[model samples]
Each structure stands twice: as C-alpha cells, then as structure tokens.
Target: MGHLFSKRKSRVTEHDKALLQLKTTRDKIHQYQKRSEATVEKDRQLAKKLIRDGKKERALLLLRKKKFIEEQLKKTDGTLDNIEKMIQDIEFSQIEMQVVDSLKIGNESLKQINAMLSIEDVEHILDETQEAVEKQREIDALLSGGLLTEEDETAAEEELDAIIADAIQKRLPEAPTDVENPEVVLPDVPETLPEAEKKAQKEKVAMAAS
Candidate 1:
C-alpha cells in the first residue's frame, strides 16, 4: 500500500513539473514574440521613410524583411496559442489526478479502519455484553430472593387489594342528587392518559388549529 501510494504521489509531482516547464516555455515564446513584433514595426516605419526619400529599392528591401518577420510572428502566435492550450489541459488533468489520489487515500484509510474491527471482534464484544447482563440479573435475583416470604407476599397483595377496593368505593359518586352527601373533590384516579387517547387528542388539537 505504501509503495503504491508513493508511486501515485510521484506521478503527480512529475505532472506538476511538466506543467511548470510548459509554462516557462510559453512565457519565453511570449517574450520572443514581443521583440519580433517591435522589430517588424520598426522596419515597416523605416521602409516608409525610405520610400518618401525616393529610395524605392531600399524601401522594397526593408519591406521584404518586415514581411519575413511578420510571418515568423504569425508562427509564434500559433505556437504560443498551442502552448497555452496545452498548459490548460495539463492543469485540468493535474487537478483530476489529485482528486483521484485523495479519494484513493481516503478509501485505503477506511479499509484499514474496517480491518481493525473484524467480525469476530464485534461478535466477541456482543457475547461478553450479553453475559454481563445475564450475570447482573442472576446477582439481582440472589440478592432479593429471601427478602420476602411467599406468605408475606400474599398478605401484602391482599392488603393492596383491600386498599384499592376502599379507594374505589370512596370515589363512587353516590347519587348526583344526594344533597346530604355533596362533595367538592377531584377523582382519585391515575392522572396519566393512555397512549392511544393522548395520540387522538393531539390529532384533534392539530386539526382544530389547522
């Protein structure tokens, strides 16, 4: 993996170096083109001056030279344009390569991380957790086992039932018109609503709001 990664990195670096070289060459071409253009313009002006002074032959010679330089300038322009295009292409390819390399590195890292957590390791941990929960339950059962006798538990249940019965009897509204036993009291019942009722009430409120 390390070797492969290093090879890819080296390739990217080489591509960058090649792009730099291309840009340098392009800049040199541009400089040469500027000088060539200046020479061509100067020659054209000199030819015009010679023609005004009645030196047609000399003027023609200078014109010929200017024409040659103009040709070279045209060729240079073409080369410079090509170099510019090449530079842009190289830059785009370099960016693509960098992105590919980054994704590769990320994928390799994820693979390594996944390797560290093998299926066996995960299963082992789950098994240990289950064992721990079972052991805890056994310990709890052992600790609370003798705290309450069967008879004692039964008596406690009976007492609870009697208390519940008495509470229900007290809560019974004898007769709504029993004036002698008039009471102003809240009901002795659980205040918590059932899940279904709560859901229905929420829906009703939402509908009303809408």
Candidate 2:
C-alpha cells in the first residue's frame, strides 16, 4: 500500500517532452561521435600498416575517409552546441513568462483592492466622522448651556461664598463672656493738715505754763 501511494504522478508538459527529445538527440550524437573517433584511430593504425606493406593508394583512401569522419564529428559538435543553447533559451523564456504572469496577477490584485477602496469612499468616511464629531460638540455645548443658567450660577457662587465665610469664622478665636470688673484704688486728699498745727500750739502753751 505504501508503494502504491508513494508512486506520485508527475505532470509532463509539451515543453518538458521537447527538452527530453533534444537531450536524447544530444546523447545519441555524442555516442556516435565517440564511435567515429575510435573508428578514425583504428583506420589510422590500419593505414600505417598498409603504408609499410607498400599499398599507398589504399592508405591514402583510408586517410581521406578518416578526415571526412573528423569533419562530420566537428559538425556534430556544432549541432550539440546549438541544441544546448536552444534549451537554455527555452528555459529562460519560460522563467520570463512566469515573471510576467506573476506581475500581471499582482497588478490585477492591486486594481481590485483599489476598486474596493477608493478616494471618494475614504473622503466620505472622513466627512461622516467629522460630522459626528461636530454633532457631539454641539450636544456637549447644548448640555453645558442648559445646565448652567445665570440664576443657578449666581446661586452656586453665593453658596460657595457662604461656605468660605463659615470656614473663616470657624478659624477665628471665640469672644470673651461674663468677665469680672477690676477695683481701682484712689490716693487720699490733704484735709488733715491741722494736726501738725495743733501739736505746735500745745508746745507753746506748755512753755507759758513753765
């Protein structure tokens, strides 16, 4: 069961098939070139033997054939180079096509997003938000204006003044109450000066009697 599931099916496109055919042809040409090289070397060895045996014409013919095979081998090498270049160009073209397709998709997605969200829509949203804020401001102003009438404000100020005056009165010292009156002593008058005079008269009388 694992083997059955592990056999993953791969998709092969026409491009892949074409590249496979090209590589196969290149491999076949390479193999043929190798065989031709071996044949050329063998023919050269045989031509040397033919020269030693005095068969000059046959050896020259063999050398001519070897030359023709070398020329054909060079042509095959050119074919291989062209095939490789074509394969590389095809692959690079595929990459460029993919890049163009990706850019197209991205451009379409951006267009969709721009279509959904436009400048007008954004401006409308901002206008609504501004209107809402203005309404809220008006509401706040109305409420504040209604709550604080002139009479209420004056009464509140008077009440606050009364509270402040009461606080100040509480901080002052209490007045004195039921206080006693103090006695003030006065100096005596000089109405008793006749006593000194009387003492002097008595002394005079005593001198007369003696």
Candidate 3:
C-alpha cells in the first residue's frame, strides 16, 4: 500500500506540468493576435490621410487653371478692342482721302469751264475786228475811183444802206439763206466803133479830087 501511494503522487505531478505548458502556449498566441490587430488599425489611418491629401491637391490644381483662363480672357478682350479701334481709324482716313480727291476734281472742272468761256469770248472779238477791216477796205476803194457818176453814187448809197440794215439785223439774228447762196449776175458790155471804115472813106474822097 505504501508503494502504490508513492506512484500515484508521481503521476499527479506529471499531469500538472503538462497543464501549465498548454496554458503558456495559449497566452503567447493571444499576445500575437493583439499585435496583428494594432498594425492593421495604424495602416488604415495612414490610407485615410493619403486620400484626403490627394483630394486637396486636385482642388488646388483646378483653382489655378481657372485663374489662368480668366487672365487670358482679359488679355484677349483688350486686344480685340485695340483692333476695332484701328479699323475705325483706317476707315476715317479713307473717307478723308475721298473727300480731298472730290474737291480736287471739282476745282479742275471749274477751271476747264472758265477756259472754254474765255476762248468763246476771244473768237467773238476776232470776228468783230475782221468785219470792221472789210468795211474800211470797201470805203477806200469807192473813194479812189472817179468813174462813179451821181446815179452810181445814189445806187451805191442805197445798196450801202441795205447792207447796213442787213448787217444790223444779222448782228442779233441768224443769217438769211439767200445770203449764203448769192446769185452772181454779170454786167452788160458796150459796143466798140470800127476805125477801118472811116479810113477807107477818106481815101476815096482824095482819089476823086485828083
């Protein structure tokens, strides 16, 4: 009975040692699970921070692009205004040039009209001078000829009166058709005495006396 009691006591001691080793292994596994869960939480926080930062950076870039576009639009508007002003200036210059050219043409036309009027007046004066010269020549020819009798003088005076009346009438009116187509009538010639007949009669009287 004493030997049996000692063997039983040794068996109980070996079972106690086995139970302690199992408890220690379970504690070590729990510690390892806790450490893994902590690492996972830390990684999730870092990913959230990265996502927020990326959104902020994109928003800032969009704002900068919008500002740049607005500045470019302002510059383009100013350039367009300047171009419009230049176009207006060019149009005004063209209008002014046209006006100047019109004035110059008008002045030249007026000068030409005045010159033509002066030429017409000069032609009229020359015609009057030629008529006066022809009248003086006719008067001198009549004074130098003594062949004009009183009847011829009277006839010439009547013809002169008619010519003066015609000239006076034509000075302010048109010339007559008969004056343009004048009849050129020739004058009658006188007969001449024969000198040979008188000479023959004288010779016959002398022969009878002999």
Q: Candidate 3, after superposition: displacement of residue 116 in Å?
A: 0.9
Worst 10 residues of 3 by lDDT: 1-10
Clashing residue pairs in candidate 3 are none
Candidate 2 or 1, higher TM-score: 1
**Residue pairs with clashing backbones, model 1:** none
TM-scores, all candidates, are 0.51, 0.48, 0.31
What's the C-alpha lDDT at position 55 in model 3?
Answer: 65
Scored by Cα lDDT, where does model 1 land? 0.78
User: Model 2 scores what on Cα lDDT?
Assistant: 0.78
- What is the Cα-based lDDT of residue 92 in candidate 1? 92
Q: Candidate 3: which stretches are off by over 4 Å?
A: 1-54, 119-210
Question: Candidate 2: minimum summed lDDT over ten consecutive residues — where?
Answer: 184-193
Residue range 6-118, candidate 2, lDDT tens digits: 54466787887888898899889999999999999999999999999999999999999999999999999899999999888878877997698669666777777788898
Q: Write the per-residue lDDT of candidate 1 for residues 1-210, one digit (tens) a residue.
A: 465456432344777788889999988988998898898889989998999999999999999998998898889888988889999998899789779878988898789879989999999999999999999988897688755789987996566545545544566566444367667554545533466754565555457658
